[model samples]
Target: MDRQLKPNPPKRKTSMLSYWTLRYFLILCIGFTLIAAGALYWIRSTSIEKSMKTAELLGLEIAEKVTGPGNRLLIPPDIDMLVDKRIKLFNTDNYFCIMVLDNNHHLMYSRPKMTQDDVRYHLSDDLNAPRNKNYAGVTVNITDSNETLGKVWVMQSKKSLTFSTETFVIVVLLLAALILCGWFTIYWLSRKLSKPIRQVAHAAEQIRIGNYEVNLDIDTKEQEMNELVSSFRDMSIRLKQLEEWRALSLAGVTHELKTPVTSIKGLVMAVRDDIVSPQEGKEFLDIALKESQRMERMVADLLDYNAMSAGSVAVRHERIDLHLLVREIIYQWRITCEDKMPEIELEASTGTQYAIGDALRVQQIIVNLLNNGLQAMSDEQTPAFRIRLQAEGEHLSIDVRDYGTGIAPEDQPKIFERFYRGELKKRRTRGLGLGLTYSRLLAEAQDGELFLASSSPEGSIFTLRLPLWTPPDQHKREQTYRSPVNA
Candidate 1:
């Protein structure tokens, strides 16, 4: 039994939940990160450009105010008042500086008065710094229609941008929620799918340990899944049945061979020891020889069955007139049976019954059926049966129906099981019950089948179906089917 087992498979101990959820988690996180990075990039670029544009416009406005219609400088007091108010208002939610320089490179006006070094030190190019720290300067030329009067420099920094925007916040929350929901759903589905498979694996383990009584009643809401469970359950049941049959078959084989060996030993020893007179000894020797022959037949049946199982027995396939074959087989069997041969009414078809099969195997199957029917009526004074031959679909069916008390209802289904002898057969016969099982195997080996067609108290019919032969050119070939008796 241990030798029958397949090699143990290598293991990767990972739960399906973790395998799927973690992998998807990584994928979703990567996707979210890329999207967030892209959105932030767009927002930062837009904010930097917007702040620069606003500063450029402010520089133009300041230059326009600092100049008169003829492009001359404004009065210092007027410039002071205008510059102070404008700078204060612009810097309310912003950080910027305003400066006006003359055409001779002299600083004419500076808001909050800073030197060149102070201006340069306060300005920065770091785009991601705080809005007040990341300052840039935009210089707009102060000019009339013909000549440049002065320049106005507007220093401004970018507005702050963060993930705290209301729309972006809402989208992040929604994305997080969707990712969590999707992961949870995937986890749930993985559990549902893996649960049955895990159960089946466990059941297989139980079977490996020779326990076939595990009944899994899982109701997975999938058609193929339910079928898988159902098939496993059925296979376990069949394995258990076959196991039981195997034990019974062993016991039956042992008991049957033991009886003949014991009888032969006793009879032979009695004659050798002169326990009986010459005439009685001769008769005893005859009985011993018959018993030995019976044992040989039993052993032969066992050998033949084993050879067939090992695929060492080859069967020939050829076209033969089944009608003629059956007639000759019955004739040869009747010669052996002599006076006790039962009446067999052969009801054959009028037309030829050509079949593609092994002739020897066919003879064996028909002979086994005849012997089974004959032995079934061991108690009857006049045993009888009928052989009905007919064309059924694409096969020729030979039904060996017996008129004796039919097979016991309980035993009918198992008659073809190896070593399964009925109660009546057990009482009347002294051989291993392999005839029907072997005959069925032979029938199947030749692209044929044997089955009990019907059974009742009054009679039983055993049928053998043989494949009909057709010529290679897709037409029926004719053979004159002659009965051996008529011929």
Candidate 2:
């Protein structure tokens, strides 16, 4: 049975604007709810306090009007009429009782004809008293010449402080306005941030599909946004360049490796078939061997280059004499390839200058440099390139100056990139372009650097900077060698 794999369900997502607006909305709802509760509490408590104070004043005024010059009570009908008119002055909802008491606290008169218990209820001062359980009351004494004649008592239900319709509606409208403003602010700011992110994501999709030419027309004054756009654009441009070099390297490496293999095969077949004399066959076999060696060198170069990037290639950190090492490298190179050799000069600074690096890797870097400088110039051009070594501060600087046809301004910047072949190298070389890139990686692994100090029509100066060997560096190397990790 052929079983098929099922596709996974897509994950859910929320947009930035909606996400932020909803969060802000929730926060605003909670905040506004608390604010509304507090406002209602304050309004109710204030209304009750102010209403009680006004009620006390009204009672005092009514008592003044009803009593005569000696604080004597008015006629019954007149007292009832004055009390009724004064009752109308209060709030529409307040239900109150007014009564009078003589000097001995005996009830003399009261509206609604209250009993003795009612008078006592209204006169009680305790908060939990019979009337205090549901009503708010105030009592005032009427006196003249320091003699208490009577008392005015006022009482009203506490329900009069309930919220009115107009106040409720006004408070609700204000809270709504604040929430609306908060939602709009969050949405506006979120959209501003999200638009650029969306554009970058779209460009990223373009890159995923192998389209490196991405045009971003976004403009933002924010510092972080500017940095993002700039870095992305730079990365896209670099990828495009790397893609071009990848294609060229694939073609070049394939052809360069295939030719030697094909040549060796044909040469071997010719010998086996007895197509030539034994003497000529021996010469052909030697040529084939050299060709095979060339092929082996190219393959090794590729493998070592990759291993260096993976940190799998073991590199020895040692103190090496630059002057002696440079001399040995040039001597071996001259002995191997003596044709078209120029009169080369070595300029060494005073003293035995030592630098910290891998001796074999240093030889590799110097040989590569010499090959590049020598191949750059022909007999017609100035045969003037020098190898100079000197100590600069705590570092050793070795400069290889070539007065050949100088590197082009455009091509100089990319010379150290892997598999990147400049115009000169493309025309004159027959292997992968990894010499400069590998040299730089090797230098950096030893806490050093390799760079082009200068390149123009006059010539190019390639400088290798390595740290000066000190007593501390020697101790560190010894420790590293003795580490158990090596075992």
Candidate 3:
């Protein structure tokens, strides 16, 4: 029976693309944010530092111009006049307040109309904020040669070297918008890429439920994904075919095995019931023996077919002479069926037509073909069965031709299918329909092919082609390691 056993669906797993994409997006956002913030802070601090240095240089130059002589502090004739002139000359945009101090650090002159806040801040007992923020200032000493006259103090207001609140707010909002856009873009792309993969996974689930007809007609941009889908489709097709073959095999085995056993039982029952006389005992016993032999042959054929299907058929490939093999098979067949056998003839293309194959398997294939040929003919009244061997190009061909009622056109195509029977009159004999199938399998497993070459009312010819064997030189040992079948 062809059983449709559906397996339970597997537990759903978490989506890897969703998790990893989000995690990576977060990491990128954090990394880029830190970089942007640090760069901004550096620019602000560098600008503030440069401003403080410029203010100190300008103050020193002003103090030099007002010096009377030597290094002694000299007050300008117009105190406010000198301060205002110097402040206007040196750009005061970067400085909140600029003041001159005497040698003792006491304030002497001021510029920019110093406010209460500025005065308190410059003269405070302790600076309250981080210098890099806004409370940055610079102080330079007024000197001439080896003497200090006074000091110049430049005050940096809280608004001097940093962006205003409005500008800062706009920058932060832009950065947030960019981060959101980037995160969403990454998420969208990940979902788009994983969509096809998800479809393939769904198809796999259906296959697990014994649905070989699941449609996988999908298009993908990736070459690897396309190949994977194609391979899956082929696997489904092969599996369906194998299931059909298995079901047919089961039915055929049951019928072949039961027929012989039933015949033996019926014959024994006839004797036990005294339905036959004692004089006919030998004939009945002979019939029973033939039935047992038939059963034994059927069992052997089934095992052989199983071995071939399982890929466990051992083949020892070697150089063999096809002419010799054909002659041996024909002789054996004649000897076995001498009581009621047709005339058999062998025609060889040459004295030695060599081929590469397993000798035992090759012999089995030839025997099977011979048996089929012999079975096709009802009696010796028909023409002789001919075994022809020839070397064609790079291959050797052996044709087993029987002169009898040829196979019908409709039945020819399926004759090599396992357990497929046709031609009711020809298949009237009680036997499993595995002989031709096994013969073809054996031939293929040996790097050879067995096919129906031609068929007509006169006869049918089954041809086998194998690679011609040519003994390799010692240097070419690496090229050939007793290769297996092309199949």
Candidate 4:
């Protein structure tokens, strides 16, 4: 069946405005709140300092004007008049009370209608102390030519400071409210902007799980998000196309299977009918067997690649001695290649060389490398292959080297790609081209890595590194063995 090809779709870009709006609005709100708080504090502090200074100046002025021989130790009538004028001024200016006291702690003068006796007593006691201190009352002592006449005390109401503090608190609360409002605004805006993205993510997830019919339901009024949804929808369509293509490829591979089986069946029937010589029939049977093996290997590799791609491959993990594992793999490969007469080499350090890994998978990786090395040198006059193992720190390294015709620079990067055949167009051996890819995948699944060290005229070196393991008991045994015998 003919399949339809889908066109590539453009990617959707996120809106720059959304980010800018949130960032700038939050910054402005914070800036305004901080500036407002700082301004209010400065105003309150300046106003309080000015009020205290004004009260001090007035007290000094009254003290200077009221001091005399009669005023020195006595209450003068002019002093009373001056105190009354100051009291009227203070009251009009929102001050609580004003009082003038003699050196004898006598309230010589006070504000009119001052029924609160506690105010007067507090002032008297505050001024009579040896050291003048301003508390609730900002006291200023009156002295004439170094003679203590009395003290002019300006008592500011606790209400004024209370009012200022309360005002500051209210301003702070307003700032907090503003911050809260900004947070709400940002949250609401982010949610609105993210809604379409969430939908697109859901659709993509559906597609990921093999749902090719998933479609995005998004509002086109939001231009940017609409574009994103459209792009995702297009991606879904392309994935569907690829899935169909894969089905077709599998069908093609299956159809191809029939030709070889038919050829083998025809050859077997011809031999039964005695249409060819026995030797010729034997050759045909050998070819048929080789072709069958090729088909089996191809199908097996395809299944492995599919399993790996689907993330369904299970790796059996356990603590394995690297030295023993490498030795076993080398021995098996040497036996398999006994007729080829390829040279094999091993190098390792003296230690436990233990690693947490899957022994079978490690053996598979070694086998794949050995097979590749052998194939690369099949045409050479004297094919030689070497396998080396070395321990370094917490890692064990395996190097597989071959003295064959090296891979071309252009083919080096794609050598590990599935189904990729290098510069040698006519394959020397029947392979599904998944050896290196499967080996790399198996290495990665074990928390190890595989990479081509170098490819030159001297051939290629593929290195494999797996993490080493050290048990606590082995460490204790080594420590005990190192202890002095005399002790």
Candidate 5:
């Protein structure tokens, strides 16, 4: 039995608006709730304290008025009339529960109905200063001269405290409604702001999936996002250009490979069919081998070009004698030029010519320069090439000069481009146009540089400069090899 594979689920996208809205809403709600609750609690505590103090002051005033008249042992007939009038005045506010007593603590008067406990006890006892009490009160003592007359007391009910708490709750509920309304408005605004961000994000996702044609409709009124969208559009255009260039490079490589391979195959078949004599057959075979070598060099140069382009070439530096290295390169090139009969010249400034660099890569750079010099001098009368070495300060310089048809100013700028051959030169060379480009790259990798010094009707000179490495002990007697010693 075979099991079918299941497709992966699509990723769920989150909205930036909803995410930030919920986050801010919760924070606001919690913050407002805490602030409102704390404020309500404090207000309730202060209001209760203020009300108690007001009641105490009122009671004290009533006591002063009643006891100020005289130190009478018994109540006068007009005393009841006075008490009735005072009760009517005090009870108008309706918040205070007032009661009066005589010298023996007997009930003298009360605005509302007073219980026996209310008249018999002092106002201090009713103040409810302890737990498990029913009411809170404040007392004012009544006295005539030095004699104690009675006491006047005022009390507030527990029901009134409960009412204050209920009012606070209602206020908090109303405030919460207002806060929620504001939060919703902020949420809507956030959604409006995040809409453009969402569009940009979706477009980015499409681009990530190789859909380069994704267009963004973001508002240009927002400066930052507009700039971002503009940059992204430019990047997409660049990516398309790069893709086209990649296709062109692949086609060029295939065409380049076909030419050499076709030549080799035709030459091999000609020899096999005996279409050519044995001596001519050897010549065809040699041509085939030369084509093969061309293909190999093309492949190697391509690889090197890729490495240089990617910045992956590692340079290993060591102390090298520039005089010795240049001599070896010229010696090898002299053997190669024997049959071609090119005039070669070598020049050097006297000094201890030492440099720190990769010797093999440096030698390759010289070889490439020499090859270019030879190719440039193909039609010259004497076919001459010159190599010059000089030492100045801490640098060693080598110049390769050729008396050939010089490079034009227009082609000079792009001469070192990979696979770039100008219309002025031979169409078919031993290697691709990567030689100069690779040599320049190798020179740069070794902390040296290759630049065209002059390219005019007289001749062209390519200069190579490397940083001279001087050992601590050899600072003196450095002028011996100025222009090649007598040996």
Candidate 6:
């Protein structure tokens, strides 16, 4: 069946700088505008209230002055003479007009006597009359010994009691200036922050497309941004290293598998075709068996490495005596490599050292390291392998030393990389180049580390470190609480 390739959807361009800048500008403008408007309204209301209160106080004083000697409300003809002199002597600029109206809605006395049209326009018989836009009015009653006489009306001009249009315009302009400054600050900050983030995202895209050469040379004053760029650069370098190793592994696998299979095939065909005598045929069969063993070993190494990489191998932790484990593994190796065998030595502390790890896995790691050491020593050299065990406060260190030509300085750094074979010219063995890789992975999975401790023209020392195990009685408590049933 054919598979359909779907095109990726186009990405929409977004400007975080523009988005946050506009939001900040609008919020500041609205907030400040409301505050300014509220302040203006309060000032106007206070001024109007103060003016009305002053008008009332003035009316009371005028009423006392117009009171006659007998405490009577003098009629309009008598009031006319007393009111003009009293108003002139105690007048304020707060109110514009004052008038006295009797209970019958007749205008009895007024400052600057009004025409008929003016009286009709200004007069109101109802107590709850709505105020006009041009004036605010207050009414006070005149009383003589608790008897109603007349009503006094005081009107103040709106022009004096409220703010002008010019004043409001000035306040709005000032608020706009502040809002503009805020917008500019927001725009500057957004640009400064988002530019580096955009560059990081762009570099990530380049990496996703398999371009490992992308450089994130961002110069930011922010510490967090600097750290982010540094981490990305490290990731890019690691990916490049893995890419190179993958290519080398592919080539090595083909070569390792092909050599053994070709030898087995050629020998079998030779024996079947009667190219060799009966005795020679038996010898060829023996060589073929060895070649088959080589092939099996290569396939097994590949399977082990794959299983580790897939995380399918579970580690069962247990207490094992480190020195005895190494000695047992060495004994097995001695028997397997009896032909042109390497002499294995175990130098360990007299005391038994216990470690926490899977015993089988730890044995696997040691066997692989020992095999690599054996392979390093050619038939011409006096083969010697040493396993040294030591305990250093809370941890155990195992050193596997081989008496062979040491690894070159250039190859030491990548010695543990998958399928990496150093000193290829000296390697006359037939096997996949994943021994060190598998050993390193196995060691790490068991909460241990494998590293090259030292190397020289004589030999190289590889060290493995694992946590020292404590007896159950000496172990620390993990929990302090228990269930009721357990208790």
Over 315-339, each residue of candidate 4 has an lDDT whose tens digit, in order, gives 8556777777787777777887888
Candidate 1 C-alpha lDDT tens digits along 1-487: 4668788898877877678879988887788778877877787777667666766777787777777766687734676676657656644343556667677645677776777655435543331122344555577888877679987877654443222356578768877887788778877888898889889889999999998889697998899999999999999999999988888889889999999899989998999999999999999999999999999999999998888878888986777799889888888888888878678889986977788787778888988888877777747547787888898889989999887667988998888888889888888877788888899889999889999998887778999999987765536544444443454
User: Considering summed lDDT, which 10 consecutive residues are worst modelled in model 3?
Assistant: 478-487
TM-score, prediction 2: 0.81
Clashes of each: 0, 0, 0, 0, 5, 0
RMSD of 5: 6.4
Native-vs-model 2 lDDT? 0.78
Check candidate 5 and list the clashing pairs: 349-482, 350-481, 350-482, 350-483, 351-481
lDDT of 5: 0.74
Give the clashing residue pairs of candidate 2, or none: none
lDDT of 3 at 397: 91
Which wins on lDDT, candidate 1 or candidate 3? 1
**TM-score for all predictions?**
0.78, 0.81, 0.72, 0.47, 0.72, 0.75
For candidate 1, list the clashing residue pairs, or say none.
none
lDDT of 3 by residue, 278-363 (tens): 86766787798899999999889889998998999887667776777667667776888787655888887656677888767877
TM-score of 3: 0.72
Quote the lDDT for 104 in model 2.
70
lDDT (C-alpha, whole model) for all candidates:
0.79, 0.78, 0.74, 0.72, 0.74, 0.77
lDDT by residue for model 5 (1-487), tens: 8999899999996678877888888888888888777877777677668767767776776676666455743434464465456546544234446677765666766656677675434344543342225566777778777787887766666445434656767877877897888789989889877877777778788878978787776665778878987888788878876666566656666777888999999999999999999999999999999999989988998998889889888776777778887887788777888887777788876754788787778888988887787777645357788888887687889899988878888999879866666666635354557888999998888888999999987789999899888765655433322212232
**Model 1 scores what on Cα lDDT?**
0.79
Which residues of candidate 4, in runs, are more than 4 Å off? 1-266, 473-487
